[model samples]
Target: MKIYIITVLLILLSMCSCQTDSSPLPILGRHDISETDTVYHRIPDFKFINQDSNYVTNSDLKDNIYISDFFFMSCPSICPIVKKQMLRVYDKYKDNDRVKLVSHTIDPKRDTPEKLKKYAQKLNIDDSVWMFLTGEKGEILDIADDYFVAAFEDPDAPGGFDHSGKMILTDTKRHIRAFAEGTDPEDVDQFLIDIDKLLVEYAQ
Candidate 1:
């Protein structure tokens, strides 16, 4: 009887252990661990002009988890499909102030604030919810590297530039938590689920 009781208690303990384990999303980058502290890879501060011509910096997004991507207003391929998938994300979380979406223009020279403003208006999204940003071409490309998205000027490529169609999910601490191929609806569908999972982590 004692042996049977021990087995039941062990099983109960295992169930309780499972119930208490709650890391739904792993932080997606490298970390540095010391005896007393662990440091994570953080997105650094940046400044850009949004479609509304307002200055946006890393501080603007403080305390908010966000989705980010890169594109140019005049892209001849892939960008439209990526934007469509991003729109689905936007529609799902538009009312959630805890979330925001940022799209940076790779063609900074041509995609000025006025140009981005016109584009944003066509999408009928509030600038506060989804910001279209323009900044130095070099800075935009540099930040793309931080997000692990490939972007650069290419004369032979479509629209005179080459870039990836990736959407990255970032946490409030600036660590990447999830991402998906923005051109693939199926991947984006999975990404949407991961976003919910990350939010559940915060809710806990």
Candidate 2:
């Protein structure tokens, strides 16, 4: 996760977090510079099965802003804390038609759609509001990098894998807007404000 932090920080260094003048949230990613125009990075296309066993793709979410994260059901360390923060995000926008939450499981071998369904059911959250995803492990890990959430198998780590608990906020255009350390309630409090601010951009 060290590499993920450095990468995110490097991208963040060139951007601002607060739009005090009520501007849109900063797009967080690498940029392709050119004399004519600059092109920003975007979350790459991917697909996975949600808790309902339905296939979900980027095109399905092209019209909505979403929060994305990584986790495994068996995580013995920070998963609970991170999930608590995510629930905060979920409750805040569960009824909003324009928002969704996507959680990709790093341990796809164990965290299947049915398992995810039970997990979601335990929280009493509808799949339309927050999706728990699982797919090919390689694809999952690659997409995790795209979202700046480190995830990989680690024999020495807890639960037999290492991962980051970063909750990422992304816009409809696939640009990352804001993120928070999911283990920190205070950071997530600010993240909630960021979500509201991002929504205001769409309202405009």
Candidate 3:
């Protein structure tokens, strides 16, 4: 009888551990949500021109989950490192139609559609799966704010602009499901796991 009770207790503990590990990632940016409130935040609508000069809006990504980041082509400090990490993410999901990558440039004047095209080509990125976007500088900054990324022009800063190296993951409903430091390989590795979790979440 004692052996049977220990086995039952162990099984129950394992089940509880699974439940804890499987809890969904939180919906960020809830300003007024109470403990009992279950409100979810979502990315707002915006339009921008992609590398191919095609307009991309929230509606365009309605059925897909995507990763988003902000950078300028001329950034000399963190952009290259962040892009390398992003490339890892790209390689992981390149063949999955449900996933996409959106890179918004803070320097619109310098990162025009043509320039972005060449950058993508140099990086060997698939324009169909990844979009390098540029538009009015102020508009791009506003959209960056929507993603909780800081971007601005700093004449004193390196390469004429300053921006955070943050990569955000959003689900099909436009909810921000997770994020990671774009410069940290370990954080990005965990982010990849989060991406898989979101994929499994919606697949169910």
Candidate 4:
């Protein structure tokens, strides 16, 4: 009887340990975004010019997790705050090969490829893993829409475009797995947590 009880106790302890150290998000309540639609919908494909003026498509980013945010290079307000927060993220993961960062200029009309390159350098962007992209206005809007993010021209607004300052995290499968507020460093902690979770899952 004593031996049987000890075996049962060992099994319970193993199960408890497994639950405590599980990889990936534990099955919880509903997610903020639709995780199911991505599993079944037709994947979006669009080409956009990168900071180098080279075309980048969904296919180009396969097998890597990427974080994307939108801002204009000439903005005088919240854009700078977002960019500063992103710098922290870049510095933390510059040497991480499997991770990438993409910043899309909402005002592509003024942010030419050369201008973007200069802006990136000014920010001390991690060129090895980060890209500041610019392309035609329509193409940029289209790609933003495909990601279920929002951007629109608002001539009345200071920058002529009303864009959200949010950073979205996409898994290697091209599904958006998490989002963080772009202007707040505290919100970036959530981004870091999700990134770590995705990396562990991908490793498996």
- TM-score, each model? 0.87, 0.88, 0.90, 0.80
Please identify model 4 stretches exceeding 4 Å from their true place.
1-43
* Model 4, span 65-117: residue lDDT tens: 88888889777768888888788778877888888998899898899989988
The lDDT of model 4 is 0.78
Model 2 per-residue lDDT at 139: 94
In terms of TM-score, the best-performing candidate is 3
Where is the poorest 10-residue window by lDDT in model 3? 20-29
* Pairs of residues at least 3 apart in sequence or in different chains that clash in candidate 4: none
Taking the candidates one at a time, how many backbone clashes does each contain? 0, 0, 0, 0
The positional error of residue 142 in candidate 3, measured at the CA in angstroms, is 0.9
TM-score of 4: 0.80
Alpha-carbon lDDT of model 3:
0.91
Across residues 1-204, which tens digit of lDDT does each residue of candidate 2 receive?
999999999778756653255666799988899999988878989889999899999999998999988999999999999998899999999999999999999999999899999999998898888999999999999998888788899999999889999999999999999999999999999899999999997885
Candidates in descending TM-score order: 3, 2, 1, 4
Compared with the true structure, all predictions reach lDDT values of 0.91, 0.91, 0.91, 0.78
